[model samples]
Target chain A: MTTAQLLGQDPGWLIAVKAVMVFAICVLSTLMAVWTERRVLAKMQLRTGPNRVGPAGLLQSLSDGVKLALKEDIIPAAADKVVFIIAPIIATAMCFMSFAVIPMTGVVNLFGRKTALQLTDLPVGVLYILAVTSIGVYGVVLAGWSSGSTYPLLGGLRSSAQVISYEVAMGLSLVAVFIYAGSMSTADIVGSQHQHLWNAIVLFPSFVIYVISMVGETNRAPFDLAEAEGELVGGFHTEYSSLKFALFFLAEYVNIIAVSALASTLFLGGWHALPGLGFTEQWLGGWFTLIWFFAKVNFFFFIFMWLRGSLPRLRYDQFMKFGWKVLIPVSLIWILIVASLRVLQQEGAPRSAILAFAAGVVIIVMAISSLVERNKEKVRSADLPEGEAPNFPVPSLPNVQSINVSGGK
Target chain B: MLTIQTPEAVMFWFLAPLAVISAIGMLLVKKAVHSALLLAWVMITLAIFYIAQDALFLGIVQIVVYTGAVMMLFLFILMLVGVDASDSLTETIRGLRPIAITAALGFGGLLVSLIGRATLGREAAGLVDANSEGNVQALAKLLFSTYVWPFEVVSALLITAALGAMVLAHHQRSVPRATQREQAIARFRGASLGSAAGLPNPGVFARHNAVDVPALLPDGSAAPNSISATLKARGDMLESTQFELSEVDNTVTEEK
Candidate 1:
């Protein structure tokens, strides 16, 4: 059935319950994510993580949340008090708002009220998430400026630039999915993925680009240059304290959850079981799709934490260059190729012919580029002084064993 | 005619006033930062109106483009330039207010007259109902097909604006910066000794000593640093001087 027929079918009470449930799920997931990150990271570094709280530190996140709530809230005497208070609220609210559009699984019956797993699915649901997350940047920027300090302002500015740069790539990467799915609705996109191979295989380049850009979009390490502790202090939330600080912290982890959920929805086939091992919706009842969805999401979450533990933060210039120069252009080109392939397929062109033409085009482009590069190198060498080589450093190779049974050199 | 009980009517009554109030606040606010923020509020309220009308694409674009990118650019500039209340009090352009008011009134009049003359309708021609296909699909169909040229031109305009900004921001420095090779050569020739000049004798300056050890002069007396000055100022220079007990026997004997 179309999304509209499914939407608004539930009574008002049901809708409210579903919304509360969604919020609860988000909070629970974030708490788990926090505890897991600490535990996993500690284990990776050969130390025990927070184990004083409820059994293996599962309730540690809750206690941390409580501590944050009870901490003394401080507003700098010189701060813009109103904006300082409003900023974190905006951040947290926007983060929660994007969760409404994500469909956790296929249709589910809750309390005899049949409804989609999502809160509400608009035809423009994906764009709604984009718009909501984009507005989240305002919270960070205002928080920085309202702090009446220098470092926070720097952090805020860095975040704005980072968001804008990565957002373009993120949006472009999604375009290929839209084209392939022939719809912008998240539900429809998932449905389309079921008809063919998952988009991860079909749109591999877009998938890769989206993964990279999502990391950049959420400001997670190694792209978390905005909040680089070695530099901008605690970044935009430097001046925030108590519950206000907790709100920013909550917003950040919630945003990570939202983006990971989105990535799963977009590229990992939403709630579909992996398209192997003869799995189907009827195999173990359709409700098992929820497990698959969360499993995929957790995989992405683990990747995020692994990256944080392994990779250093990217320098700001290198980060921006990667976004604008590499990611954007590559995605743009991939979109062009995808678009043309779709057009050719629609026009009844033979698959072999289309593939051959695409291959030939790529070869010609590469050949021409290589020829141009050779000519440029020849000109550069000819312009140099004949006998004087530039004093370029060459380090000797570290001690190595030479083979004895070799021809004379 | 719209009924008061309708959702759109209620939304209009609520949000329109909010937008107006915020817009007014933007104008009347003292701080430029506050004004910029209030302007963002207005933009957001307008976006809400668009969503209320079921123009989801328009609403999302409104927030994403104007509220997100444009106002962000505005606040970034305001904070970076650090414009305070004192800066706004000075009139940089003398006698320009009257001209601006006249121009604004003329533009408003033109807009009003155009609207008044146009045929007003509750239902516009060739328009699909809001519950039809997704507005994004409808927009894309129209944008990529019939209205493609104008859309491309608008993007080109945006590109031109970006190029113009780059050009305007480019500055050709009057004195070129020293290359790394030049700096290295200068350093090797001892022409670029840094922080070496104007430095006080290491053991003589109080701050220079790692453990706050006092500096010593050639005559084995404590050097006249800030530490010695504080001791002298307090009239305990003779009694508290560590140099007298340690190595300033000659100077102490002579002074006494």
Candidate 2:
């Protein structure tokens, strides 16, 4: 029933097989996400996407990938070739590695053998995911440095700093989930939420923080200033073309899916039996779990694509300020509140009492912040002349370019 | 105790060949950038050797920090301050240097073999369990437990190195950063490419578009404007020299 049970039950070779499958799924899913994004966006805007390719343009991604591979591989004359080449490889590899532990559709029939859908689920699976995803920043940083071109270099640098900043918020946001689940193993976390109540419902604030941070982590829409086409031209992969470019794109979408799947598992109860579906031990118990798991995952994936269409891209500076000043602080406070609730629960306090205490704490904190802001504003109003420009850091070029290209005026 | 059997034998699996190739590559590369790149490869392969020795944390730190960060700094400095291979071309220094480098290469190979013999020659694959021994969890536990002092020292070393880099970058050298460049184009942010200064009016540079120079800096040279010299050095200086062809007709045309 727990993640450890799922992981330990399998022969190690099944894990190896699942790992390979996860890698394939990520690569294939990314291709699909790309094609779907284009097609769906086209339908929204009354433009044709790649209709003439394979059936329903499903195979267009395949053709594009092939063409990209066959294209001329041009290492920039002013670039660091070894680093440039290795950057995308590392990015793509790390992306593949993240899904190795993800429960796709838990437990599937593999040549008559039943096992957990995950590759290798450890007790510290949550920390493992964090550690693995952190490596993604290396690709961005290396891509920028290796290119030796100013813009790509800047884009890489921005994305790395941006990712590291958001990861803190993201990591903090995860703390409450860990506390609620009482285990870091993702499968265990899901199993702990078996009372028909998801962590997303129990820890709504933490869930919100995690969702925002997840979008930022994957360098998705609004948070995708690193590759803002208008400003960066191509961002980190500006100089990269052919197969190398495809790899970067593949890594982005794959990482997006992996992160989304993780979100589903942590907050939405991974691979749990949906109320509508009949539960049966007649089927391979583990494989049945995978089916339920993918349902939640697919829904989240659609949300990712939907958000891409619905929202406009975010400004760079605004994104950073939100992550560092807003998200981090909010998550930290939420974590403290969650910890207090856990302590109260251990001490035999009623759930209602704990909830009331949390609400009171939130209100008091809000009142204090507002009071401080008002005092600061009054002091500033007394000192400054009318129409005087507020001093701010000389906005970095990519930050400026994002605004300028989007016709921000 | 985790015993290493025939440590000398294990080191030879990679270290023997790695040491030879890196030493030869470093000395053979004429360009400073090329040599530095070669040296990074050497450091990386050496780290791989470390990984084989069951030091996962060291391997990752070597890759993430040294190859990723430190070597990057080395390359960036090499580009930001362009090097002249011509400086290494003094006839008097060259004759003696070849012998010196050749001797150094031989000596290096001998040292690698001796080290390999001393350490890995004794290490048998039979000794290593090789099963998840140096994984992140295992490595973390090891660092926090018995190896805590060395682990703490490593962090201090990293901080010191970072501060030292900052200081070095800020220090004023005899040559200004921009001046040493063959064609330094600074503060000219016209377009995203920022290659406009490097690019001629197209018509002036070549007739048939036979060359991609000035408009393109050669690989490894950050100075886009200095690309003409790079191309000339490569003996691919476009189709024709602008001085003779005069494709621009003196006044420049705005290219699309």
Candidate 3:
């Protein structure tokens, strides 16, 4: 049976159990993700990270959570109290909601009742994920605006614009996946990749775009201009304190995990064993698929940390420009190509002809892109004379006399 | 008779009143942000209704488009325009209020009558068969086949709208923008060259690095200009004398 049908047949008690399981997994993964990010980042920067809490600081996040909860909660006098309280709740809840449709395992036996390890898989499952995430931005925006502070307000506005722009690119990137999988339901998309090649390998461009867009969407480093510390202080959650601040932190990590899981579900093949290791999926009565699923998720999460550790945050204008001028347009063009390819395949085109057609499209796209780049370079060079710096203000250094260390007699 | 499953029926009943009340609150709210939030809530309810009716594709699209994108843009604009900027109740346009009330009533009556008539005329045909293949697939089939022309036209309309926005937002510089060198020259040529080296860094040398501390000038007096005006206004600045060294007597009168 299809995963959705299997999920539908689940009893009420079983559904509740599965719900709790999904929640537990999300929370646990978030804790692990935090520890992993810190440890990984610390190692990258040549520092010891969080080794005092538990074994290798395994329980550090838990301790941090307790500390955050116990700290004094201060409500800024200028803040709109109601929205301030609601914002983090909204953020945290929405992140959890996105996990409802993500399949973590194949059909598994629970108390002698068979069920798929997922919540309800709506016909518009991927769209639902996108919708919830889009709503998730509201939390940040409201938090910033309600704070009644300049930095928070600016942060909120930046986040809104950033999320909105990247969301378009993110949505368009998924179109290619939808076209190839012929479904929007996460389960069906995963099933489509069962024995076939993963969508990441098949639709490589879409995978690349999706990966980029997800980072931007989740407000992770390099694309995390919303809460840029040097610029907007703490960004949207600047006014939040104690548990409220922790809630936003939780929401951020949860969002990262959500997008990672989604990337795995869409591109890496959710719950499916790696290529040539399909037999392992049946190990431990098929429960081992959960491990495979999380392994893929961690792979994406590692990429997030790697980015945070290596790349500097992008300037706001440059980030927005890339999103609008580069990612969105490229994804749009890629969608067109994918749709046309799907049509050609439907019409029973010969493999060689299809391959040649794809190659021609790629070449043309590359040629056009290169031409645009060259034109841009020419314009830039034309704007300035050789050996002359672009006109910008730079203060001249004062002439300093060399200090005599020895007393001259 | 319309048939809704028990769970859906419960959800509809619970959310319907909240939706209507929020819609009313959206109109009555004084704060633009609050109004936007109320409207978002209403839109979410509508999405839930669509989903309950098994129009999953429509429901999700409604959310992603209306609540997520459109309402967000609305809120963004409202925030930019000043969230506290409310319309004056004093009508500048004479008779505008009366005209608006009449129009609203007429529109409300028309919608109520239309929906009532439509619902009373037939039994609700659930989406079971239509969604047998899958709601998204079924919708896609109709959209790509039967409604293709309208879809294309709508897309064209959207593209035109985007282009129009770009055109509207495009501003031509009345004068060429000053280069950095020009700006620097203009700055240096102005009343005083005191600021040519840029504002002094805040805080007294070696003693404190806090932004609230005023820097010590060459004569050992506090430079108020060194500290942020905001900090000064907030009465958070520290006295520079506290960090300055006390004077010492260097006379040889200690010969006794």
Candidate 4:
């Protein structure tokens, strides 16, 4: 594909403008996301969050940023001074870097030059995103270690572990999309989806898995064991103050938008209009597609807010177990199914034949799982004492009161 | 956006020395955590070197794996275990340090020789051709088709190593564990043999948060709380540390 088609390799000035615009979009959207999150969460809780700052608290995040900028920046006596200072900057910067590959809209006319609305696209665009996010873990881990404090250290470790675990599942989920699209390029993935149905519909399980992984990836509520306020104090940024703390905050919201945009790109058809709303794109062209893209991204962001307001933070161990044992395996199975289907299709298998094969595979898998469950049941039943009835307290068990008295005596 | 051009020679000269300095710093740093961080910096510089050579995929992977996951693991372990608990100065094995130095020197010599013999960038000459087919796909095709067996073998080995690690780390208790109900009852009855310190004091008594009022002992003297009592009992607390310099001076003068 031509550079013009894949991405707008525009004049240097226009490209610079696009870069500035992307930065502005990320920062502005983060401000809006923070405001929207507060307002939405407040509405959910039957309270107004920050109406005093701007209209419906639109400028509340801005004020908070300003306040943070003015706060006393404390570098703890024992902290590794350099790492401590650099960590938040790394976090925020790395978070923004992933947006370089995101296809914001279709080809658009800018300053009388036609170009696709993206910063740049690599052949390994999706992998580049994964690599960047992986590197972002360093910011947290380093921040925690450099703090020279207990809570931040714990928080940082938890964040690293959480990111590593969920990232695997997230990567696996995307593999199905890559298989279906036959390319890893973000623009190509979107183009492929436009040619057919959205990957979210075709690969429903992968989409659901990606949604869950994105929440976990961003350390949002339910999966946010890393910064469980009830347990970890302020988490990795506990010792961070002033602009440094704001940077971490900025990185987090930016990351959320980036991941949401990625989810839009990968599964929701990027800047493509909704299937039923194709008329909007047809009439308005590329600009309307940007609207659809942002709308989808914001919709994901809304779900993120709803989750934070609704769900309790998951226990660290439970979160990890779910990531490793449930999500990874399920995604693995789904990828297997998708890969086989693709291979069969490539081999000129008829549609019905492919569907039948998929059904047979699913049935076999279900049967095996049920068989294992039945065997477990049998083993558990056998392990019970002969005199014990199922679901009843066994008489052979020691009496709690007597045991307590004996221990005391 | 500004049409920035990379001067590869300048970048290599800059990053290569930084990488070497950090690698040496990683070895010499007294703190394990600092050493890990230094290693991460080295890894990052190496990634930049890869990027300079147009191996963008390799560069990203280097950062993603080495600097990110591996270094994080090292730092995590260092931090969690406490930086103070670093390896002891005393070598457990006799002549181990000399042997280690000799081995390292020999390895370095071999590497230098190998590098001097081989034409540098010869292997990398194929990078442009690979880039034409898309680096990721090209690399993937080569790895899966040409080096397929070795790749599969390495993957299997990694899996085996993971399984082995899990097995080694697994602890099977010889004694049956107490039921949660039993443990709860024991705790409630104050019958559990919790620790040598007995039940911890609910109030602050010593160190940073000393209370103005002390606990009255059964014999009427003010009793030390958990932390102070533990320290005193273990003979780790110095008597002079608990009092003012004037009081200690007075006591010493009176004794003299």
Model 3, residue pairs in steric clash? none
Q: Provide interface RMSD per model, one decimal.
A: 14.0, 17.8, 9.0, 16.7
Tens-digit per-residue lDDT, A180-253, candidate 3: 98888999999999867999999999999999999998889999899899988889988899999998999999
> Candidate 1 on A3-67: residue-level lDDT in tens?
55786787889889989998998999989999999999998888999999999989999999999
Q: Give the chain B TM-score for each candidate.
A: 0.64, 0.41, 0.65, 0.61
Candidate closest to the true structure, highest TM-score: 3
Over 4 Å off, model 4: A1-8, A282-285, A350-353, A368-409, B1-6, B84-89, B93-95, B102-126, B174-256
Cα lDDT tens digits for candidate 2, A76-194: 88887777898899888888877766666555577567666678676657766776676666677678767878789778767776777787888899989988877667877877776
Models 1 onward score TM values of 0.82, 0.62, 0.86, 0.81
lDDT (10s digit) by residue, model 4, range A1-409:
6543545457789888888889999999998898999999999999988999778778898988898899998999989898899889889999988998898978777777887678987767898898889878889988988898889989998998899888999999999999999988898899899899999999999999999999999988988888888899989999999989999999999999999999999999999888887778745546788898999999999999999999988878778989999999999988988998889989999999998998898899889999999998885565322221112111222222222323323
Mark the regions of model 3 whose C-alpha exceeds 4 Å error after superposition.
Answer: A373-409, B92-125, B145-161, B174-199, B202-256
Model with the higher TM-score, candidate 2 or 4: 4
RMSD of 2: 12.8
Q: For model 3, what is the error of residue A78's alpha carbon versus the real structure, in angstroms, after optimal superposition?
A: 1.7
Q: Score the docking of each candidate (DockQ).
A: 0.23, 0.04, 0.35, 0.20
In terms of DockQ, the best-performing candidate is 3
Backbone clashes counted, model 2: 25
Q: Count the backbone clashes (under 3 Å) in each candidate.
A: 1, 25, 0, 0
RMSD of 4: 9.6
lDDT for residue A263 in candidate 4, whole number 0-100:
96
